[model samples]
Target: MSAKALIFYGGWEGHEPEACAAIVEEMLQAEGFDVRSEAGVAVLGEADLARFDLIVPMCTQVSIDQVPLERLCTAIEAGTGLAGFHGGMGDTFRDAPAYQFMAGGQWVAHPGDILDYRVEIAQPQHPLMEGIDDFEYRSEQYFLHVDPGNEVLATTTFDGSHAPWIAGTVMPVVWTRRHGRGRVFYSALGHQASEFTNPQMREILRRGLVWASRTTDSRETGT
Candidate 1:
């Protein structure tokens, strides 16, 4: 059977939530996953979630009712994987403690806007970072308030731009965390559709999705 993947997108139209979901769905489909795309958090029902193998929330500033939010949490904890990029996943549901706990981190700030920055690979051996090297990109330097327990995969160096006084700041750009029995992978990139189309970025996302999916063996085990 093909691996099932559901993409929930919407909120803050300026970010092009629909476009982001399209790209993600296409990529996951190409990776042999049966992908489903939807807009808004309301579509995240228990039935919809139970039928899928993974959940990709592309909704920026998602404000879901307690019912759907709880359903999502329960499904994920039962071993459904979750993955996404930028505000769609991280900056969303800022006031929802359950959402925050499931996401493992929150997007607190993006200092210096979209500027040239250097991303350093922190875990080269990780499946998501494998065959990838440190690269430079002219994008927003995401200053995320990350969970201390997360396994960081990549970081970006902040130069003196937004604040002249704070130079040489290092920030986590990619990470993974375990929430209950679920796996969560988050990347601070993809502020726009163009960013997702980058070959390197696309590869990073594709690998991350696969790595975040439910596996027959435990993640802690080499198997």
Candidate 2:
């Protein structure tokens, strides 16, 4: 049977929530996942979440209620993978502490318009990054406030656009972290559908989903 994936998208329409969800759903389906897509958080239920092996949220700048937020966190902690990119994942739920904790990072700022920037692969040996080389793309350079404990998968040197003074600093653009028994993967690359549709970006996301669904227990305990 194909692995199941669920995508919840909504909040600010300007970010193309529905379109983003469609893109993600299509990509996962192409990879043999039984994907489901929804446009809002309202469709999510505790039972609905428990049935999926992966969850992707394409929401932007929105708040989720405490009840559903806790439910989602619980699901991840039980080993359901969570993955997403850009405002859809990082810029979401700015007010909720639990939501922020589950995502492992929060979007704080993006200085310039979509401009040419370089992404440096930090973990070339990691399964998600393996076979991928550093590349440059013309897109928004996200300046994020990331968790200190996250396993950084990719980074970019700050350019002078947002703050010229901080040009030399390396900022994380993609990362993963363990949230209890589950895995979390996030990439700050997709500012729009055009960017997300890039071949490199699609491959990165595909590998990330597979990596996020792997369990250490299954590897060790053979369960």
In candidate 2, what residue range of length 10 has the lowest lDDT sum? Answer: 214-223
Would you list the clashing residue pairs of candidate 1?
Answer: none
What residue runs in model 2 are displaced by over 4 Å at the alpha carbon? 214-223
Model 1 residue 19 CA deviation in Å: 1.1
Q: After superposition, how far is residue 120 of candidate 1 from its true place, in Å?
A: 0.5
Tens-digit lDDT string for candidate 2 (56-117): 98889887787888888888998888889988999888998787888888988777876899
| Clashes (N, CA, C under 3 Å) per candidate | 0, 1
Model 1 clash tally, residue pairs: 0
TM-score of 2: 0.92
